[model samples]
Target: MKYLFNLPDFPDSSFVMQITFWTGKQILFKNDALVEQSGEKGKPFLIPDGNGKVVKAYPKPSLPDFAPILIINGEKHRIVAKLPWYQLVLALLPLLLLYGGALGGGAGAIAAMLNMQVFRNEDSAAVKYFKVIGITVAAFAVYFLLVTAIYSVIA
Candidate 1:
């Protein structure tokens, strides 16, 4: 997906970055023009801005806080869409609840993926929160069903 970032010294909405979630490939663009591209996931790309200045961009794929950052003249710029606090808490509920043990961890992983996708989207606040709640309920229901089936089999 393409993420747009506003650099400190640059014009409004000048930086554009694309990061492949699964592959980790990162592409950087300035004002709709391709500046630098990298095939390796999570690898940093250096782009020469202007007047012999260089900008270092990093594609970070860490869970719950997956945001790419650009280092322009020693300052860091985040390239991520912001979500509301309530929505953020709701999205993280599943991962917080079912985070331990093998079966629970599986459910947590699924929920985390869903939450991550929800946060990554550029949708409206209401839609994002709805997705978070919907995904959380769905993950819990699936976890319950799996546990029931396993218990029934053992008994």
Candidate 2:
């Protein structure tokens, strides 16, 4: 999924920012042309402005708040518009189920993948629900498999 945001307006400038979900690729465009891009996620990268002056850009995490931030030149900007309530539920759903224990860690990893996709806007409501449910089931399967393996080893 991709999230797009309009950069703060500048004189004779038509800068639009594009961010790809999961991979966290950020691209800056001016006048509908690609100017700069970076694949750094949760890290800073430099891009040249319309004036040919370099500015810093960083991609922040996409969880808990569901508000992914893209900081440019010491200013904060949201890459995605509109935070859906379902995203919040998906982000916190794993926490409610997987808390503490070895099995929890394995399940939590699966949940993390789900959390990543949950933020993507491309999926329909029904599709998103199925993803959440499927991931939850996969987590349980991992937990059970781990338990069975551990039990057999102990026996």
Candidate 3:
């Protein structure tokens, strides 16, 4: 996803904008430039402007905390753009429902298939399949344990 925002009071001069993801991935954007570069985790990088001033880039504390600070000539600017937590939860709801549906054997399988379709476009094939299988297995394991407990109680 592309994050777009304006930094009020920022100098009009061209400068580099850097973003470090929670997964240790980095992306760099040049002012009025379209090229992107990867960044290193836990390492500080310089965003130099043509006027000889440099801005420093740092990663946020954890996932969902999209605030990254930019230090321009010793002044700190915290970028406050972030994806809402509800939106993220909504995206993952299908996977959670798929697991819940797994409590029923054949019915669960159908539900899982339907739920998997929701994420078909969001992730790559490998990732999508991996998550689907993983959740299904985990749900089946939980269901088995529940059944075993009930059987023991009845006997």
Candidate 4:
């Protein structure tokens, strides 16, 4: 997802933001360009400016009512836009539907929706589709077995 904000205080300073995922993947985006990235999963690292100063990037801070904050050039800029929770729910809806006994085309459709939301930009089209199919099938099998076991016990 992309975030846009107006930094009125520091209008001339170029900004870079680094997002460190839970898997320790760091994606660095400076303005519109990706400056650096790491695919290896481990501890998160700091994003350093060209002059060797570390830019502070926080995913979530304790400061109430503040979004993700980026400290660049000693100024804090709040990221105004964020991925909506409903979008996240939409992405995970397929797995939830599978648990609720929806299968077949319904599951596939939901999985497609999820793939569009979650993997569209990150992975190639073929890989995204393959992951969607795998996830949908796995979800269906697990949920079907769970339902069958429950039915067997009740019957």
Best-matching candidate per lDDT: 1
Residue-level lDDT tens digits of model 1 in 14-92: 8777767656567778888787645456456666666687556665543455555665456666777555676566767
TM of each candidate vs. truth: 0.70, 0.64, 0.38, 0.36
lDDT of 4 at 15: 48
Decoy 4 TM-score against native: 0.36
* Residue lDDT tens for model 4, 7-124: 4543554444443332323354555556543233422224545577654443434232123555544565566544455434434545456336454445544464444344434677
Error in Å for residue 142 of model 3: 18
Candidate 3, pairs of clashing residues: none
What's the residue-level lDDT of 114 in candidate 2?
Answer: 61
Candidate 1 clashing pairs, residues 3+ apart or interchain? 24-41
Candidate 3 lDDT: 0.48
Q: What is the lDDT of residue 87 in candidate 4?
A: 39
Measured with C-alpha atoms, the lDDT of residue 68 in candidate 2 is: 63
Using lDDT as the measure, name the better of candidate 1 and candidate 3: 1
Per-residue lDDT value at 128 in model 4: 60
User: Which numbered prediction scores highest in TM-score against the true structure?
Assistant: 1
The alpha-carbon lDDT assigned to residue 22 of candidate 3 equals 27
TM-score of 2: 0.64
